[model samples]
Each structure stands twice: as structure tokens, then as C-alpha cells.
Target: MAAKKASGSGSKAAKTTRAIAIDAPPLDAWSDLIGHDRLIAGLSAAIQQGRLGGSLLFVGPSGVGKTSAAVLLTQTLLCERSSPEQMAPCNTCPACVQVRAGTHPDFIQVSKPDDKTLIPLELLIGPVDARLQEGFCHDVHLRPMQAKRKVAILHDADFLNEEGANCLLKTLEEPPANALIILIGSSEQRQLPTIRSRCQVLRFQAPTGEHGRQLLRKQLQWSATEDDELQVDSVSDEALDAAIELSAGDMHVAIRLVRGGGDKIREALWNQLDAPVPDPVAIARLINGHLDSISKDVPKRRAALRDVFSIAVQHYRRQLRNDAKSGEYDPATHRRLDRTLRTFREIDRSANLGTLVDCYAADLTLATTGDRGAIG
Candidate 1:
């Protein structure tokens, strides 16, 4: 493959950042990747020393390549010929090619079952002593077909709830020697503190606008106007004003209101002059304010956060399905959309009107639009 540059123009502030993809050499240059040198360097060193731990946690937000890094590390470890200074896999090599195609016999991807979201208790943790007397290997240590070390990659480590996390604790603490358990997660804090302390953690952050765009462009092949390759499109003045209020500088959240059913709320509010519509963000603010007041009024803040997240997710989903065009939506918006949906799904695993309306005004604001008068 050819080498490629990572992001857009890097600001001086970015030098201190831990964004992904930035350090990786693009396939174009395939050698001079700009940002990820620190992480790459560390992992390279670990693999060389053969001191890499059996259990590892790769933490950070989406799209940055915790998964990609795991894949690369797998490549490096499995490569037959290794120079003293170079631990990266030569992608053109047969081992690299097989790993890239995911046909490698030794690599096993352990994740939540397709039908179930969380890694099941029985699957991760073995049965109690009496029941498990037969000495069978745990699901993870079942051994690879041929490679020296069996690799088990767990993506979305954060999705494992308390029960799920606990189940893996025993295995994580005493991983099999033949096993390499690599976990891909968004953040250290997102997991239990006890779990956080056990394994070595690698943190990744959002790419700079430039590098982010490069990855987006190369992989997504998206076509749009951009500032230095950061393909940001300005919504109409009305949408901008609303998004600006709701999202602050988090463009990901702002874009959702534009591409998704966010326009529905806009369209609904444009009737007679006597009325007005609220933007989705505004609706969030209005409802959030009330929820805040109630939380302040009451002694605690239980369930409110979850409630807001669930309600907002429902709203975003409506927008997603309503406005989906050829399976496209702003990346940021889509992320927010997923967040809300997942939150609701979990809440529905247990856990809506006017005062209740204030409860959902922020979502309504996003959904409704255009009416200039007042909250409708």
C-alpha cells in the first residue's frame, strides 16, 4: 500500500496530545506517519523485549485505532523475520497479508455474543469449582490453531457491565501463558478502578482535524467542502445558531442535528406566525434546566442523567431513520446518535409529558425547527 499523512494542519497545542492515526505513517508515504510515534515506539520496544504482558488494555474514543493497533501488534509479534530496530510487521509479507485478511489461524476475537451485547457471565468466567471439575480451558485459553501465542482481542471493553467485568477479573489476573488478551476500550475511567489497576493501559485520543479528515477521506471516500481537509459544512444560520448553543465546540454532536431527523423538529415549527419552533439543542437545554432544578430541589441526582440520555437517544434514532439518505450522516452526529440509542437500550433493560415535556425539551428543540416565536 502507499503511505498517507494523518490529519489536517497541526496546531502547536497538538504536540502534547495523544490522538491516534496522527503518528501512524500513511500508506502513501507508508513510512513518515506524523503523530503516533510515542505509542508506536512504546509498543515496538515491548514486542522487541518479549516482555509484552498477556493482558493489555487499549483505551480511548472511537475511530482512533485501538483495534487497529491490536491488529498491528498481532502482525509484529507473528512476523517471522524481525530486525533489531523494526518491530512493525512488513505488511507485504505473507504473515502480514494473512493477518490483514483475518484468516490467521492463531488470532481469536472474543467479544459479546452477536445476540447479546455484554460478554455473558458463563462465557467469560468458568463455572464454580464443583461444576467445572472437568478441567476444561476457559473460553479465552482454548488455544490457537498454530501460532506460538494465541491472541484474544476484546473490543468495546467498556460495554461489559459490573457482572460482565467481574467475570473476566479472574481470567485477567491470571491469564494463560499462551494467551495474549488485548482489550480495546474508550477510556481508563470508563472501566472499574480495580480492573484499571491490573493491566497496562494504552490511551488514544481523537485525531486532529487534519489527520481525522485524512482517515475519513481515505477510508470513507467522502466528498465535501473542507477547511484544510477537515470537511466541515456549515449548516444554515438557524441550524448553526441552534447547534452552537447545544454542542459548544463538539462538532460531532452539532452535526447530528443537521443530517439526522434533526430537520423534523425544524419543519414542524414553521406553521402560522403566531407560533415558533425550538431547535433540538434548545430543547435539550430547556429540559436539562428543569431536570437540573429538580435535582437541586431534591437531595439527589439519581436516574436523571440516564433518563435524559435515553430520551435524547430515542429522538436521535427517530431522526436517523427519518433522514437517512443512502446510509449517510455526519460522523459526529452518528456517534451521538449511537450513544443515545445504547443508553436507552440499557435503561430499557430496566427503566415520559409537559413538566415531563421540560424533561425532553432539549430533544424536542433538536427535532423541531424554524418557528421564531417561542417554544411550541
Candidate 2:
């Protein structure tokens, strides 16, 4: 492995601000990795067997506890005290407290800067303009300050540009002793082949069925075992179920959906779905207005729009699936629906939300009636 400089240099001031000295929260417990019992067991067994390696890659959807796993694994590795067999951290220890408070000297976490599109190389290897500064690459090579092991969680591995990835290759390939490097991303394919080959990859899947519902209940803090006890005038078990279905197994998304007027949003979506031709612009404007009324942040509004599109996609998919089951599926209509779904999936934050919504509605209208203008 060779050392190289990552591309797209940042200004000295930018570099200083780009790297956030985060004091990440310590894992509540390894049990918090809900819906992943088998993976947890395997990892615990690996710790017991002393087979844990330096470089581990966790790949999964956005909200599936990949980072949480990284934090827990760090605790297991660096805990001042733990069980002889299972390697569970003793939460009462100073090491555990520091790790929990994100103030651990040996534990470092880095992520893509929210203001930038890509993780700058300067952030990984230190600023290009500086000669004697510690970035992730240089810092990881140093001995631990407080613990026997040093753990670094690279949160936005996918955002690492070619240069940044190359710069970190040597460190990743030949990590320093008593150091653990964890790379997290949405999928294995998003990572460079070089990065993927060097690390032990752990794939995480979405919790579904009973696992999903249980997690939702836990997250929502609903303790009612009986259905009647769970029901409130505004939010109920049915609403929770609807959020779970809409979220498509993504718990973060489900939580967001539930918090952001789950029942009302679902009702509005279904109403639009039943229309002869759903008016996407009107729906988009309505959603935008609602989100703006609550908060002025554009990202918040964009997320709301994405949720709306996701619901639309779910509705069309159900229609297509039902048609197929009944032997009434039309190939042309099916193709159209598939295209509409693709359009929704592809809508990004870069696109104008209102226009994107209009385009989606038009596409659906065209798919159903061959008249794109019908929805407008």
C-alpha cells in the first residue's frame, strides 16, 4: 500500500471547520442493535474467540444501526472492564462513560461534512496547506491516549473521493497495532474495490414483520400490549402499522413519518391515489406549505417530498402487484408504472421539489391515460 494525497483541497480555514471534533454518544448496549440477533451473536462469538480484525466494513441502508454497531464494537474493544466471555462493556467504567459522552480520546468519529457534496481529502490526510497537522490518517497511526485500543469510525465512506480513498489505502491496508478502523456506507458496491477487498464486510438488512413492529413500538415508547390500550385519539397502533408499511422497513424513516403527522399524511396520499389523475403539483405545494409552516429548512421540506414520492411508489407497486395476482396486468401499463416508480426513486435534493412532483404526477397520468397534461 502506498500513500497519496486526496483531491479537491480545502482552504486552511475550511479545513479547520470541516473536521468536526464530535463526542459521539456511547452505545446504550449491544442489544440496541435490534432486529439483528444473528449478526450480534456472531460478532460476540468473534470477540470471545479473539478473531476480531483491524479493518471492518459495515454496509447497510441509512438508518439500520451501522454506526451504532461501530460504537458498540468500539466499546467492546476499549472498555476498561468487560465480561470474561461475552466482551460486553461495563457501563460504569470511566472508559465507558467517556465513550458514551463522545469525549473518549482513543475513539474518533468522522463523517461527510453537511455543507459539502464530498468528503474533502484534506479532512482525511489533514489540510493540504498544513505540514504538521493530524487528520484521520495521521491520527490513527498514533498510540492510544486512554485505552488499550484506538477505534475510528469513518461514517461517510461513500463520500470519500478517489484521492481521499487512495490516501487512506495504506493506513487501511496496514493499520497500526491496537487500532480498529470501521468504514460505514449504504452499500458494498458504493465502496472502492481496494477498500472493499481489505476489510471484513458486514451487511445489515432492514427489520421486517414482527421485528419491525416491535422496534417501532420501542422507538415510539408505546407500552400497551393490548390493542385497545395502544389506541389514542390522534395516534394509534393502526397509524404505527401504516408508518411501518410506508417506511418499507427503514425504522428512521418510520419514526420520521410517525412524528410528521403519520395518519394525516397517509390519508392525504390515499386520497390522491384514488383520484382519476393525481395532481402532483398541488400535492407538492400542499406538502411544501405544511412543512414550511412547521419549519423553514429546505432539507426538511425535501425530505417530506421524498416521503410523499415513496408513498406514491408504494401505492403504484401495490396496484401492479394486485393486477399481476389477478392476471389482469397490462405490459404497457406495467412498464409505465415502473418508469413512474423509477422517476420517484431518482428524485434528488438537487431537483426543484415542485417541478419534480409535477413531473411524477404527469408521468403517472400519462402511464394511466396516455395524457401527460391531464393531471395539470
lDDT of each: 0.50, 0.68
Candidate 1 Cα misplacement greater than 4 A, ranges: 1-34, 81-85, 92-94, 125-139, 142-144, 222-359, 362-376
Model 2 whole-model lDDT (C-alpha atoms): 0.68
Task: Candidate 2: list runs displaced more than 4 Å.
Answer: 1-26, 83-85, 131-133, 221-235, 271-283, 286-290, 327-349, 363-376
Superposed Cα deviation of residue 171, candidate 2 (Å)? 2.9
- What lDDT tens digits, residue by residue, belong to model 2 across residues 150-195? 8888887988878788887888899987899999987898799999
The window of 10 residues in a row where model 2 has the poorest summed lDDT is 1-10
lDDT of 2 at 145: 63
TM-score of each: 0.54, 0.78
Q: What is the overall TM-score of model 2 with all chains considered together? A: 0.78
Q: lDDT tens digits, residues 341-364, model 1?
A: 343333323222333334234433
